[model samples]
Target chain A: MNKNSLKILEKNRDPFRSVKLTVGITISIIFIFPIIWMMFVSVKPDGFMTTNPVEWFTPPYTFSNYVDLIMNSLILRWLWNSLIVAVITTILTLVITSLAAFAISQMKFRFKNTIFIFFLLGLMIPGEATIIPLYEIVKSLNMIDSYAGLILPMIASPLGVIILKSFFDGVPREVIESAIMDGCSYLKLFYKIVLPLAKPAMAAIGIFTFIGSWNNFLWPYLSILSETLYTLPVGLPVFNSTYSQAYVQPMTANAIASIPVIVAFLIFEKQIVKGISFTGIKG
Target chain B: MNSKKKAWMQDLRALPFLLPFFIAYLIFTIFPIFKGLEMSLYEWNLVRKLEFVGLENYTEMFQDEFFWDSLWNTTLFVILTTPTMVALALVLALLANLNTKLQTFFRGSFFLPSILSVAVISFLAIFMLQPYNGLVNTVLQLVGINAEPFWMADKTLAWVTIVVVTLWWTVGFNMVLFLAGLQDIPESLYEASEIDGATRWEQFRYITLPQLIPIGRVILLLQILASYKVFAQILLITGGGPGGATRPLIQYIYEVGFTKNNLGYAATMSYALFFILLVLSIIQLRSQRSEGK
Candidate 1:
């Protein structure tokens, strides 16, 4: 390699590297400090955290906050509700959106463009705007406080279709045509060929939908009147308000709501980042 | 069969696949839009349609002080959060993109808060910003700054708290996007700049900054739209209190519809917000198209 290329290759060994590292680590810690505090405070034994000029580290930590939350509160129930709602929302969104996207991308039909645009119009219509009437519709259908009420409206977002349609479009038409020549029905082709080929896109959509559903607070907060039907995001705030007198138990509940998602995020960090960037750019 | 019949059959074949999503979209999305507009034109309640008020809701919304305050608050939040978020995300992305062994750790720490639910972050904000014993005030006092600022009670401080918590919770996602943009910058450009003896700052100012403009615009507009929708965090953290200084339009709409059972007025306000968003979206689409050329 030439001298310039050699210097560029050695850029990682530049003299300012240590300074960069220090800045990076410091900033990262600053970003993560609140969450760290929440976790530490959750475990601190009562009266230990009450000291002024709050201590970052206090020994004699206990799991009593967690124990109290699990034993006394409906936290587990809320967690269960959140899980079911997010899972169903993700699965249904994928199925419904992908099916529609496949037809729009791969099938020739009258009003195909019109239909695609109809769904795309949803991209402009924010979910917050639709809630008033959506609540009315849900109430009329007697679906308030039910899983369907939570899951169905969420599946209406056009994002999955918008993302997946492009992916479906990229599938080589020759393969599809040859499969059709081999007597494959559209359903069979969709499940046996196109769906498998679209795994990466599907995964991206699945992650987005799952995270969105799990973190959804507004709709559930408005619709769910019964405490039992509350999701984690909905239930935690109510729990906080009801128990505002104490910090430990509430922090424990925050930690409880957080830990699982954090663990999942760590596990799927790459895919999650990729998914978000994709949707953020595309949609 | 005639060609017309065959064409119709081709359309019919796609029907089964399209039906499920369309049905849900219609019932939940398209239907709600028209239904919301319809509701806005009447004196509706949570239970039933009380009367056909005929634009009275819209007229009242125009004159309502709370409506205007909430709308202005939402706009103010968009102004507060969007630029700061875009600029900060760019910095964090640059930092996270540093060629270091701890790259993954940096990325994880920065993005970690984003995975947290709004409630978790809002609760953490409240926990940390307590006037007397909160982490922020305590830390400030430790550093010899003795003012125990009430973060949620004061108008300016409440906005600060909401904006900062929002940045902490969301900037990671934008950082990830910026990182993606940064990575896509061709290595050859940097190498060529190095050969020309350009300093790092020069390289960044000329090549990196110019290259990042498109993604920066995307993040800027996305942040604006997202900030305009800010509700749950403010609602939870301050309850839009200290005299409703931080209440966004969505919170007002929620209160009107659910709290007061005035669905008509609520729906009217929703359409107002929707119209604002629609105009912003059109601007985004226009800019994107022009850039594409």
Candidate 2:
């Protein structure tokens, strides 16, 4: 939106600017169309969706689907499960990764390179590859169907550690040394000094972890046999699947599941984009 | 001052810092990995008594036609999706990068689907692509296609539907990467080319295409691994349906393991999946090296 940024490109002054706008609008519509259509359908009553599909906005909208979804299923409990897992995962990831990152990047630790490389190994290992063994491990430890089963494994995100480590490394060494000279303990230095300065980095990592945890479905779906333990993503689909007749309630469930994530993205759009690009470009 | 003893204590500080993640990494990732490998060598589901049958599972993998079928399905998916996503991502990135006031809105809207969970997107897409009563088919009918397409039911079209859904759900991330790459191309280069009377196309060819290639390769490599790993969306959308028409390898593995209780065989399939990804990882590393970054 900055005029200054626009001034740098010669095409900004060209007559083709309108062409760009039209094309941009078209593509934007395509990208957001699914969610918009889902929301549109969510509010409409049964049999009205395909009748006048084009007139998506002109609605005698109802909250029937939402009411049906809530009344029929353990949706509120599912949402609660999602919230606890997401929040606890975020807190645990931040606490653990921040400390490890500090040591890996900031301190003169033994086998530092080896430790960092060990974490890097995780980057290549996909969740699908590990889930088979992890299932058995969790089962053996009697953590299955517990929040710990979900939260504990998710805490050791290698990317979070690397992101924070790189951020911490950029902090001047003198900043830490000066704090140490002032009789700061190592733990105090982490909480009171390094962490505060790394707020943007922390926010980025936190949002990423929270979003990842919130949206996680496969592991939760596989491990949680009981309806009481279902997270939103895992629970919503099963709820949706049984509604083979009308899509209204299903769309409502999806819309509700999607809202928090979209809201989070909207609130931290810049940081989220920066965090993603950071993972790509500088990862 | 006890500085010598203090220095030793200070050096030990890193241990406490590193403990939590290391402990977690050990249990979740490291332990599961070895367990998966070890269990793959056994002839045991969770219920049965364990029998050490090394490489029997491996041989069964080679002999099982379902394994080959699923692998082919996976390869087909990767082929169908990766290039289309890469090219589409580039085009979208270019359009969004156009010097305009609506750039931020365009970027955010385009990236919106990437924020939603795959489960949400898959169900929403199913709603969109749902046969004669679906929005897409309704539009097709309005436009004069008499025989309405069964997007998820027909075999070939099911693949197309899955690919289209994948593109919609994920192309945003790739666009963001490419956009980052595009912006990194100095405006000064374009400006200089314009001064030398280079046409817009010429400027794009000389400056834009070359600069975008490295980023494109990296994104391509990523999309290959990611596309092959597609599961949740496909699982929900088609349920690998129309009689296993849309079943990718991962779904097959999941079904074999849990539904049929063939954990050993499933783990064997998982190892095969891991090997394929490992090869892709090597190619990614090689491409990065070639990019000389």
Candidate 3:
């Protein structure tokens, strides 16, 4: 090898590069192992978790856990309930958050910054801390075991406003003013003029909201008393207690419940990345 | 005259747009926070009559040993989780920044567990850590070690398990943040440092670390806040087992408010958590302000 190529190769061969790859691959395996292991156990025999300690990779791979879980439990019903709650919450959240974002970012109003700052306080107050009061509020409104109880409390989200507002802020003033000069109504300016441009941001907000609502356990567990209305996160625990003996079977249900969001995340990973980075930047 | 009328119309136009979310936020989130503060001062149990016992609940909370224990446990959790997750994420981000063919693959792989629900992650943890014929114990036994320590049932291990499972479930997010931060750092700085014969560690310590501080603050704040909210996973995994060693303030408050039907006292404990978070919030906002934004 020539001297210059030798030097280039040697520099590239610095052990840190290899070390980084090794560590990266190793940690990635560790991170992903839980999900993969869950999938494996989900397909394993019902009683095999306790009985068959050895032979993890060999002989029997069964579909009994998935079958039994589907037939015997209310997993699909739980999924349906979660879907309904998440979809409704996502739609409502989109409307409210986008409108609020538009007003805060685009419009001229008195107390605009002050009102926006007030909403920012909600950023510090997590939903968990308010569970007790929220429970009482919902129960007093007779919303227990109902869809409204699940969906309403979630509609007043703050992050979407922040993210979408930043995006809306980027829309040039000239565009809005030109639209106004053409005698466009404010509502038309928002729906027709602004929203299409903010569609990517909307998608990011929507997926985040949906995944959030889907994964939420605390609120649904507190609000929904009936089995029929239980979301997946809440429902899985009850199933765990009910079918305490069949450990592997419930894991099948667990895997099933986890699939939608994981898939959603995988499919929308680019937008989700943009969303996450946007949040970090705007923070 | 016409300008004044148009400005008036503009103000009204903005209100309708803002009001839907504002009204809901007022009722559910904002009002409840204030109500929670008020509830802390009273002795209004769910079933019992509402009687004014001003400051008694707060006083009782101070003297309450269980309250002390839970608060300690929560602080322990916050201390353990936030730094470990953030540091691990920084490491993963550094490694992923190596620009290999496997970069995207490893990034996505590391992040996969994070998108799964906490309940799902907790259940998976149980399968691996079940003390008897569990995957981890099985593997350990195969390697000639007979140590199958009670993972969740034991007090200390339950704490460790919660933190570890939490790391598995959440480090992806912080890793993504660090990756973003790392990418934002200009490549020219590294090139300049390399030309100056700076070592890898020096470059990272000086350039990368300094650049990451702002995002690091955000991650630290978020991780602290998020770790404090940890409940369902622990509730299912440990169930505050081995004598309430793993119970956080949230779960503790949840039990008091709902299971015990002592909503007032629960709200009192909730107020304590709120004040603690209020301090955290102030620190966070202060950090944001110091960043000149």
Candidate 4:
């Protein structure tokens, strides 16, 4: 309350405020630089991309790269493949994970703990570690070069089931009990009570699953040898290799591939953040 | 009697929900893992007759120089990248949490790269790290730091460069997670610390750090496990290197399986990687749980 006290308070605050600002600016620049640079390069004339001294802001911006990518590359097909696979995978993951979570959390069952542990073992096994063996399995099934091959293996993600189960466990047990007591079938109880209460967690799981399936590259690359079945991530490299001289084409393809994810993040930023936080907590 | 029958019926009803995952896991995960273990015992080409060689592949892996080199490279990568990436993510999260102008801009920019598929980021990284006309080298020249090291050319530096690129690509996702964790910590704790004449450092040490420990441990574990399995960037950027310098275990397995047509040896190596990850994750989980207690 005294003048000297107030002055000291302001002085102490000054260092904290300045430090926060400096740190904030420094991190922001580091985070933003690559993305900004990529955008600049995508628009730059082909020859200017590797120019020394890096004239990042100059004009002579060209749409030729975009035009060339659209006209020649299988970029659209790859995008389609990515979209179909991601969407189907997301849907399948949600249904199976939610149902399994429901059974584990609410339904009375013997060996429930044992089954949960079985799924938990999935948490330890990295997908890459299983890739070689899975490749053999896929080949044996003759599912190579198919969307089913990509989507089927991904749907059994143990992480999804675990997250959903944890979420459903936190739901008030009385609600499900009452629903059952009211002569509601188990299916109806799940449809009405559990699904609605589980929305936030479901949204969290959905966004995580969508982003993961979209970004998946290794399995798709190994399994799908046909160019027609290539996803965006896989197809972009092949496009780059074939058109090695045309930097613009691949750059444009990269930019296009980024659009859907960017749009999804912008729309559901909060849910995505929450989902990531959940993983950090449960991880 | 009726109650028992109903319970049985309930269990039966649950079967459909569990069936798909079980079937898929059996076909894709459980069965293949066993099959992989079986294959590791024999030497079989894709089209040729199989030869049972017992633990010969495992023994060969121990003596094989490339196998050891890849394992070492992967371990080094996991060690170098995990801590830096996790620490950088925590710092970025703290920075993003501050009530500053451009908060959204900063968050979005950091996350932008993570959203982009790995192919795009790897391609750009390769282009940027090129020695002669690359953006990084060009900037280094301006700063008067001559003698630019070829990132993917030299053996030692190639692995280091790949690790750096991996950190850049992934740090944002971890940062986003950390930011969410920061948000969950009560603002009143910081206020109470301030009232008690706590400096920012003390506040961070006592209040913030304790709250973040659980999240930090999880992130660290995930990063360690995931980084050990790093393959795509290695494949795309260095193609397992300018002499196997950057080949991680996963890429090694890939080569053994696809290139050499030696599924058995590949399976054995993959199992080795899995065992390492399992032990590491268990250690992390135990330490964190004990710390909590």
Candidate 5:
């Protein structure tokens, strides 16, 4: 490397580094603005959010919105409903999917490939296409306005089984074979060996299920008619409309509703990223 | 007989774990899909008797202007948003992958919006796009671009607002996927490119893009399909209003089915959307496979 060449390299690298830094910082701010704004509005006093030439961050920040939301709104009810539905759905989905994936991946059951293909075909059918019929079924079952209606339908996720099945297939066959040679039953093998080995993939699937169930709008919106039974996403809109006069309070309600999923993501960021990446890879 | 009994018992043991999903699918998914097909052929309100009016609903759907408009709007949205969101996600992922001090913070910040429900985001968007007192208009005025148009009022601007909001909410997830893809790409490739005196652009074009293609295709397909089914944001933000400017097929279907009690017609419209998505996904998958080959 000559002196002139080194100088040119340094110049090029400096500009490249600076451009990268600028772009990175700009994008970070753009992405973070909405959530930060939501939090800001939540703490701001009523009528302050809508002021002309809007104050980005006004003084005399009030925790009254949060206090008001807690005392007045059906937030706790909605959060409890969301939690029950989300948690049950996640656990049920993991169990069913892991078993189905194991069967499809390891067991040579009759029509195994055919059943697997059937599930894959299910992936192509948009939920909107079947929603009307689902409504009818829910009505017929007299399950409307119940958590059973909300959670039961979502328990069967084709994407979950497909992703987990692929992950399970990557588990070395020798481990299974050795377990079988020791007179281990299929159930015992799955519980003792497969479940533990597939923990990362299971965590990924669980996170996906939880986030999806938490954010689900259309299903709960259509099914749950009772205000008392509404989940956060469904309930927040109705709450906002009902309390339209109090702008900051609903904003506070909205912030409170989003906290669980946001906190969940922050804690299990790795699992969330892994789950999203898995979806991208398999799709 | 003992061996056969043992085999049957093992199958029974596996049954408990698999039962929930199968039962859920059979009742909620498979049965409803078939019922939806059946419902499309009938003329009945929730309380009224079903009359066999085969194909009438489908015929009526073709002449429906709202259906056509919604379809067009949805198609336009899918076309506009999918590529831009995927590209932006890829760029963000690349930037995040670079060795820097604020990598984790930047990644976390970008992902923050995705955790909120669409309803909350749309409400905030309504505030931000307020014509007089909104932050966006204020920013535009500061930049000397006075006479900033109302984003959610005009038809075209409404569509643009929906797309931008959707992108902001979704790009983080796709970016995380791309980041994972980038991490999977061996560090030795970049080192080798540097050794060969390859410029960053050349290295990205050759190594990064090629490695990211499979992940890219997945993101593209998911975005296309998901965007086609957008309803919540549209409902919350536009309500398919300002003269139905932002109405998508799903929202239209919801209105027809629940609001108007036109289940038969809504079924027909949903079927049409189903067919369009089916065709597009097949084409996308075929093209992707051929490209890989």
Candidate 6:
């Protein structure tokens, strides 16, 4: 508690501080090394890899792999497919789930508890387990290999509803009562009042939904029979298999595949981290 | 009766809002569950139902050697990944949580891989672990380990590649979860403990570990469930090869259903996986409830 002792504690921390810094820097390099290496290799000449004790960045590097990837491969199309599917799925999931959440949270509804529980039961049913029947249903509808098959089924996961509903529940009773007193329709109240109030939760769920749809492989892989219909995750594997012998192209393909997500992460870093912890704690 | 009728009329307004999600949930999620069960009872294919062979698929599944092998493989993956994931996540979280200038950098780098698609990570695994020219093998050779292991060919090494790649790809999310939990722990507890002259180890043993239990439990269950669903990474990295040593149940189901054209049998295997998950979930819920009491 004395000033001299406080100074002594500070002095003791000096050595430990450097130790901590060293460890942190080392671990961080280990974590980040793969992606950096991938990027470096993608640009390096294919023959350059033959060097013993491979260097991180010896350049005679060229843009040919990236150029070949863009010119020859269907990666751009797959990226487009991934983009539209993820964006549409995120938007639809948020809108539909928020509506349901608003009704469940703010409205006096018969079978409300039953409907809520019905959706919650979905949390138990992993999508992987249901893929067989789901495929059957989609095929029966003749929607296979189509964007509808990719986007629509992905919109209905129950997690968004559960997350949004909890957020909606936090809206004060008086707020709803006053809105109703102003003769506001329930729909307007949801759009104007509740949705705005729950923007942070919405952003979290939106990021999660986007990421899930973007990374979704199994369903899209199964349903999409056409080469052009493939999302990034599905398309990349087929590309990898077909071009497995080549080094630079496939590695460059991986780098290209990651660019969108990495950029999104850098921009929405806080929201993505919050979204992950939100799903974990809340689930 | 009149008041009840009025309440029903009042609740009708909710229908417009609830209908869209419910309809999708029904057709996509709820319906497939029962439909999968129905499919399991029949001799079906990708295109059509072959015949109703009630419980035959299930019975055959019980006897199927590949089914057992794949199931065991999946369970092995779960065992290999879960505890290591927790411990590693905890350590990364603590390191990131340190009062350092590079805290954000630590968090970002650790989490960056997790945001990537499975395709990207799997490709990196194969690329980095290439026997002759890959980063990992090259690095090992430099360190004087001359026997450069073929990462995806040898069975043990294949398993190691899958497990380590999986951990590297995923452990970040759990680390973030633990970080959130750590931040939630009241600083006063640590301050008070320090006043008691508790050593850092003692403080961590009692305060930090105990406070992390709730999030830790959540992470454990989530990790187990996730590890059971392991498919893409293993498939891409190993292709479940080395004579199918790493083939998971989901991959097996895919082969049976799509590749082999036996949907009925595949559906049966899916049910087996579902049952394991359901039981694990029930156990988790039961324990949580008992603890709550």
In terms of lDDT, the best-performing candidate is 1
RMSD of candidate 1 to true structure, Å: 1.9
iRMS per model in Å? 1.7, 2.4, 2.5, 2.3, 2.5, 1.9
- For candidate 4 chain A, which ten residues in a row score worst on lDDT? A1-10
The per-model DockQ list reads: 0.72, 0.58, 0.60, 0.56, 0.53, 0.65
Candidate 2 or 4, higher lDDT?
2
**If scored against the real structure, what TM-score would every candidate get?**
0.96, 0.93, 0.94, 0.93, 0.92, 0.95
Clashing pairs in 2: none
Against the true structure, candidate 3 has what lDDT?
0.82
Better of 1 and 6 by TM-score: 1
Cα lDDT of model 2 by residue, A146-251, tens digit: 8999899888888788778888988898989999899998889889989999998887778777777887877898788888999988887887788865778788
Model 1, A18-51: lDDT tens per residue? 7878888888999998888888988987534554
lDDT of 5 by residue, B115-172 (tens): 7887788888876787766778887887778897888779888888898998888788
Distance from true location, Cα of A14 in model 2, Å: 3.8
Q: Give the TM-score of candidate 5.
A: 0.92
Question: Candidate 1 chain B TM?
Answer: 0.97
Q: CAPRI verdict on model 3?
A: medium
Lowest summed lDDT window (length 10), candidate 4 chain B: B284-293
Cα displacement (angstroms), candidate 2, residue B172, comes to: 0.8
Candidate 6 ranges beyond 4 A from true positions: A1-15, A46-48, A281-283, B1-5, B285-293
Report the poorest 10 consecutive residues by lDDT, candidate 2 chain B.
B42-51
Candidate 1 chain A least-lDDT 10 residues: A46-55
Q: Kindly give the stretch of ten consecutive residues in candidate 3 chain A with the minimal lDDT sum.
A: A49-58
Q: What is the lDDT of residue A110 in candidate 1?
A: 93
- Candidate 1 ranges with C-alpha deviation above 4 Å: A2-15, A46-48, A52-56, A281-283, B291-293
- Indicate the DockQ of the complex predicted as candidate 3: 0.60
Tens digits of per-residue lDDT for model 3 on A73-180?
Answer: 889899999999989999999999999999999889888889999988887786777778777778778887899999999998887898789889988889999999
